[model samples]
Target: MKEKLYAIYFEPEDWLAFRESRRFNPGDTARTVFPSPFPFYGAIRTMLLKKYDVKLEYHQKPNLSQELLRKIGDESQPGIIKLYGPFVYSESEGKRKHYFPAPKNVYKCENSGYKTMHLFDTKIKLNCFKIGLAWIPEVEGIKEVTESYIELEELRKLQSGQSFVLCHAPNLIEEVKTGIALEESVKRTKEGMLYFLRIYRFKNGGFFMLTDSEETVKEISKIEGVFLGSKQRWCRVKVEQFGGNIFQRIDSKNVAMMLLTPAVYDGGIVPKEGKFDDAIVKAIAATKKTVVSGWDYTSGKPKPIYHAVSPGTVYYLDKFPKDDETVVKQSYYNEFGFGRFVYIPYENLKQCEGGEQNDEQSFLALC
Candidate 1:
């Protein structure tokens, strides 16, 4: 049977606490919106085990839990599932509106450096300074800093219809929670008060599709364990047949892959410079990097620093590869869905197209 794609929405009840990298502790930080798909992957796997009794020994305990160990019985196989998003959302007029990462090629520079994203919708060049204006702190109230940095207006113009919210949204309320380890307890935080970042709850989540598990989807939806980013952060989810047209159609071979969640590579192979490697560039037109790191659950230790191709970073493919099997076998991270992306068909921007027009065209594909 040909499996169908399903949409699963995860609405966080409270501020989500996700630490992508464990490099520092005292002042832990969170990726404002960028997320890794592995955590969501693990969530789905756990759902299969709990809901439909899927036998996934290989995934549970790769070493001790193998196919040979399952000779005892033929438990139900996990439904083949593929996921695409953890896209942000915003509630307007009492309804949830979906948002993807801002379109690429319209970013402004900050004092630190250039920032990139994987969940963009189109491909077109733009002068960052001309789009928006920014303020320079050192210049003492100097606001004409577009030459070096992007202003809030232009950035929002690019992200307008998209569901992404800036880290510094005025409506974004945050709270600092303090905790302390009990005396004589064997907890990681056995020393002093631990502070946590808790932002006001908002509506933003992701989508998933199960290839072989039609019946399993029903059970999975009823299981009440669907989450967006981290296990600790529980969310309310809705599962149904996907109805939107944001995803690229099957026939479109030349595609634009926008990362909804942060993708993990073997050792962070995404390029940092404007140019990409020939082989990589052959398939991908442009690429950028987003650095992230987190704790490894198994080792209970901080994960290595990861120079991931950040979520919202866009990659243009001259020609989409057709051999799915070879693509998986040859690429280390492809199968894992680390750098997974969605296809957006190409369209040339009109000469008169500006921010508003570009934003309008972004949703045209959906229409």
Candidate 2:
């Protein structure tokens, strides 16, 4: 599934139809008009542009103070100011009001002299039947992030500096939280639809699919625990596109794959349906490869290749490296007798198309 998985976070109005219209691949997907202004906004938009060839940008509400809106602009693009609040959500004569919920844990604004959500419909994206954005972040991740957490003081503080707000947010969570989710504009290819479990994050990374149809969507939606994998929904590839050891020996790989597969299987946290925390664990007793993940930001955390890798335990790279360095330095070459070459899926294993968490673990496919 990692092969078909990608999550991008983009700003309101970042959608450049002029630039993206040319890139649309017929079979990919994109989800746009996310709930908030997340840093992931740019990354999600970029990936969608490359994959679905569509623009999924966000929009902001006009009710905010000019000063406040200006501050947010440092981190975002211009938002779409509106004519009225939710009252004007639709121009249709009979459509009385937009759905409303009694506000909770509401806080009055001290900085702007207003009340909680005083500026109703004060977000970037406007609701339109033509657009349908889905919510499944918590559904796919090891943990979930929500709006309730965001609507809190802690969340407000987290989003303080990068205060990019959206207009016309879809009512998914009751409140806000520390992390905001920016959904990319989705382009449905409408082919043989299927869901995938991209094992890139598993002990031995690989991609797998569970074929389903429109009927499956309704059933899956009711699961309440599972997440919608990708809007582009694709079929899986038989070959391995990502995963494996960074510096492994020829004989050690089979051992590695065996140890890792069960860890992901046993942990049972791989979104068999979304459940968090202890649901996932390392199978140190089962894995063989020294799962080494690479980091682009910090110096990097220590790779726990030895801890959970055993015959029974599954190996998690927590970030396994997938770069030319890993392949070039760890190649199965005869010239050097000491660091003897380890054969791995070099060309095919490194190019992963998923989001930030792609290298977090080494996924293995048991099926």
Candidate 3:
């Protein structure tokens, strides 16, 4: 019935390691910025069960948890609606600033057409131009290229002083941790187990919303902390509520779907390009490849190496095809924040907000 919003904040003790691939050898364990949403879904379900005094199981049956989670549905009831974040939170001056996923369509301009190059200069430019309107990218710092557009309609949710914490979207930094490999039979330490390097750098937080149903807010409010993500990579999160909707109204005719979290599509690594339904609307401007992993319930093992469209990818639709049913029917990939996005008027980029310079005292505090 009513709308309820909850934000999850994770404060790591020191570092967290989300193993990207299944390889577990010393110096072979790698990590990524974020993990797939299936683990998060499992984590929340575990929390709910714990709150309800349900027994925790070592091994859960296939799809059994899905049926159990169905009981927590809202009035609209199309499964559970979830939106994960790739936003970056850092302090600017005395106030805090939020950085959302900049659409992949925005790029560095060369001459007339387009060029893909990182902007590494004295200062980054906040000014941007839309497709067909620009003349020079050689002069301007950053420019939006052909068919390059970002949706801001749903972003109106952030306009009303509602702050959100991002999940699984971390700037990866590498660090070395030391450990000893043990011998099973002799019960002694082995050699060549001195140290290993891992990508320990990541921001652990997620911002999501839930429909207030069956006293959902009541149970969640009582929660002080919950362990999210990998068990070995223990992350104690502080769950709290903030004001305003994280998503805004999508009233524009031409819209783009941007990935805030990595999405899994069928078949090949590249997301297939096609229309919504024959010619209702066509899909254009899919971005490059991103790797993501998840825990499999059926086999009870780490899922195979999978590729997903990275966050900040912009998928242009011919028009915002005015059929809610069509979007819902084709939105199977959106369950885990894959094809989830907001609709903005297909327009040029506006200057971003909150890019202030902070002193050392302020900068050190966030670290």
Winning model by TM-score = 3
lDDT of each: 0.41, 0.20, 0.43
- Estimate, for each residue in 183-278, the C-alpha lDDT of model 3 and write its tens digit: 668868654333232334544333233332334444454555445544344445544554454444456554555555565544232233344433
Off by over 4 Å in 2: 1-55, 59-249, 257-367
For candidate 2, the 10 contiguous residues with the lowest summed lDDT are 81-90
| lDDT per residue (tens digit) for residues 215-305 in model 1 | 4465456656554443366766667664333333345533444454455543333332211222122223323554454434454444455
* lDDT winner between candidates 1 and 3: 3
When summed lDDT is taken over every stretch of 10 residues in candidate 3, the lowest stretch is 117-126
lDDT of prediction 1: 0.41
TM-score, cand. 3: 0.56
Q: Each model's TM-score?
A: 0.51, 0.15, 0.56
C-alpha positional error of residue 132 in candidate 2 after TM-score superposition, expressed in Å: 48
- Candidate 1: misplaced stretches above 4 Å? 1-4, 24-32, 47-79, 91-95, 107-200, 203-219, 226-231, 249-257, 264-288, 291-299, 303-305, 320-331, 344-367
Q: How does residue 141 of candidate 2 score in lDDT? A: 19
**What clash count goes with each model?**
14, 73, 4
- Report residue 161 deviation for candidate 2 (angstroms): 48
lDDT (0-100) at residue 229 of candidate 2? 20
Q: How close is candidate 1 to the true structure, as a TM-score?
A: 0.51
- Ranked by TM-score, the better of candidates 1 and 2 is 1
